[model samples]
Target: MEALYATTTGLLAACGVYLTLRGRTFPVVVGLTLLSYSVNLFLFSMGGLAMHGNPAVVGAGTPAADPLPQALVLTAIVIGFAMTAFVVILAMRARGDLGSDHVNGNRLDVSREDGK
Candidate 1:
């Protein structure tokens, strides 16, 4: 289970990075979202992979799960959602104003003599 979880997290991170390096805005946004998801998974795993552990309450038993990582991941999720939304809006506005979705506001396929 641990190996599977690690592999999944690594895969997500790798894909996210690859997409982020692309030349388009949509893929960049998706990549960032994937990266955030991977980070959340990592943070959640830090609290341990207890399958049936009790919550960390006042009178919990020995196998109580740590609540800090859970809380942190929850907070991160909310923040990531908001950030993603904002980025999408910004990308849309950029596309509209620049007439292109490329990250640099210029189509790469079109050749330019000045090499801008």
Candidate 2:
């Protein structure tokens, strides 16, 4: 189970980076979202995945999952959502004013054609 979680986290991070390197604004936003999700998963996993574990509390007998990671992840999710929303609005404004969705302020097809 740990191996599976690690593999998924790695895959998500890789895909996020790949998309972030694209020229388009939309893919960049999606990549940022994916990256944030991967981070959240990793943070949550740190709380441990144990069966029949007691709730995190002081002086609890036996094993108890750490609640700190869960709280941190929740806070991170809200912050990530706000960041994504702001970026998306900024992208829309840029597209409207610049007439292009590319981060470099030029269309990829046009730039490629000009290069050719």
RMSD list, candidates in order: 3.4, 2.5
Clashing pairs in 1: none
Clashes of 1: 0
**Where in model 1 is the C-alpha error above 4 Å?**
108-116
Q: Cα miss at 48, model 1 (Å)? A: 1.9
Model-by-model lDDT, in order? 0.91, 0.89
TM-score of each: 0.90, 0.86
Instruction: Summarize candidate 2's per-residue lDDT along 14-58 as a digit string, tens digits.
Output: 999999998889999999999999999999999786667788777
The worst-scoring run of ten residues by lDDT in candidate 2 lies at 107-116
Q: Lowest summed-lDDT stretch of 10 residues in model 1? A: 107-116
Q: Which lDDT tens digits does candidate 1 get at residues 1-116?
A: 99999999999999999999998799999999999999999999997898888778886557788899999999999999999999999999998998888888875542352376
Q: What is the lDDT of residue 60 in candidate 2?
A: 71
Judged by TM-score, which candidate is best?
1
Candidate 1 local Cα displacement, residue 105, angstroms:
0.2
